[model samples]
Target: MLARLTIFVLILMLLAIGWKAWAYRKSALSALRKVEVISERFTRTDFFEEDNRRWIDSGERPDVVFMGASITSRWNPEGKLGDLAVAQRGVGGQWPSHYLLRFRSDVVDLHPRAVVFKACAITFRPGVNDKGTRRAILDLTAEAEEAGIKPVLATCVPVREDGNTVYGSDGKKLPDGINDRMLPFNDWLRTLAAERGYPVIDFYRAMADDRGFLPADLAVDDIHPNDRGYEVMTATAKPILETLLGAGRG
Candidate 1:
């Protein structure tokens, strides 16, 4: 009886948290809508392109490079990937197409021993489909290979379906359909990695719950993860990075 009561109370508490989060919904929605607007009107190719060129021309070779969208942009693995020179080439709200466009300037020119491409979480965005995302990644990887950079892939972190205002679990079937698209992307990447004998770091499994949602505790809102979530992400990614770099060196 006590255990059941505890479970019941916990559920109630979560519901309450969800309710409180609802109050902030409109603002978050506005911010996200603005992001999508910006994405549609802009390309971030100019954001840090010249900086990467300077680094390359200076002859400073980073040991590893990470490329992706917001998550990759926000991740600071310098301390976690310790002692190894790391490069971050993440652009906020970018999709695979954006990354592909800037690949040579941001990544290949860096002459990284390996590149870890973190998939973005825009599988639900309009005009963006799973097949396109898949193709972009494949194109990026192929380009990386032709440039002689080791291509390492990573799955995106989970989304807190309830925490995010965009698709919160507000008495609705919330984010399932959006995330339904996510699963296939992940599955395809994993299968492709295995088939090609490439390294894949599974950040999705690290931050996801049994039911596949980003556990509320690990996420900040809906799509972005909190420090604890990124902590796990970095930990999960480190060994794979180590192995990839090690193998590439030999």
Candidate 2:
């Protein structure tokens, strides 16, 4: 009876250990799957592959190419910006690094006369400095110049006061305080553009309210522009783009 009891206890211990191992493996797999999803979303280098191929096949070269994040993607510069041929290559939910990664393919390969670089407000969220972002912009500008393409720097639009909480592609909440860095980053962008002799489109000045937030009427959310907001942006960008295009022809 004693031996049988001891064997029963040993079997129970083995069963418990097996269950724990299985649970651990399941948890690990779940975490890994989440990471994979994020990685795929952020590293979408081929996001514009099909569109780019179509453009290339059409043999139509644009006079200006707008390259940035979601805001740029939603901006329609076609008939709004005079008669200049414009191509939109904005990818939503991407960082400056991603822009740099696809710069040659998206901007340079299209061979536009000028390229506008407007990273979104999310690129300079709270706790982030401007150093790396500056470097990436410099690299992009330099590459464009080397390829005989002019580079234009556009200020990022401000976020709405109430639209503070942004979400990541993984359905997680992003950090707050995006508005804290918006103005300062735009200032830096202006200084950088001046130093590099690049033209800047002051979208923030056109879109921000007196308190420096995007007004409710102009914002699609905290970080994007509504139709009216984009109209303001288009009005602000028209003169700059026209000047650039005119000078490029000269």
- Highest TM-score: give the candidate number: 2
Q: Which pairs, if any, clash in model 1?
A: none
Tens-place lDDT digits, model 2, residues 71-114? 98898868888787888888887667678888878878888899
Clash pairs, candidate 2, are none
lDDT for residue 237 in candidate 2, whole number 0-100: 87
lDDT of 1: 0.79
Q: Write the per-residue lDDT of candidate 1 for residues 138-221, one digit (tens) a residue.
A: 898899899999899898776776533234435444444556777778898899899878899999888889988898788777
Query: C-alpha displacement of 147 in model 1, angstroms?
Result: 0.4
Off by over 4 Å in 2: 1-41, 126-129, 164-176, 247-250
Off by over 4 Å in 1: 1-41, 163-176, 247-250
TM-score (C-alpha, index-matched) for candidate 2: 0.77
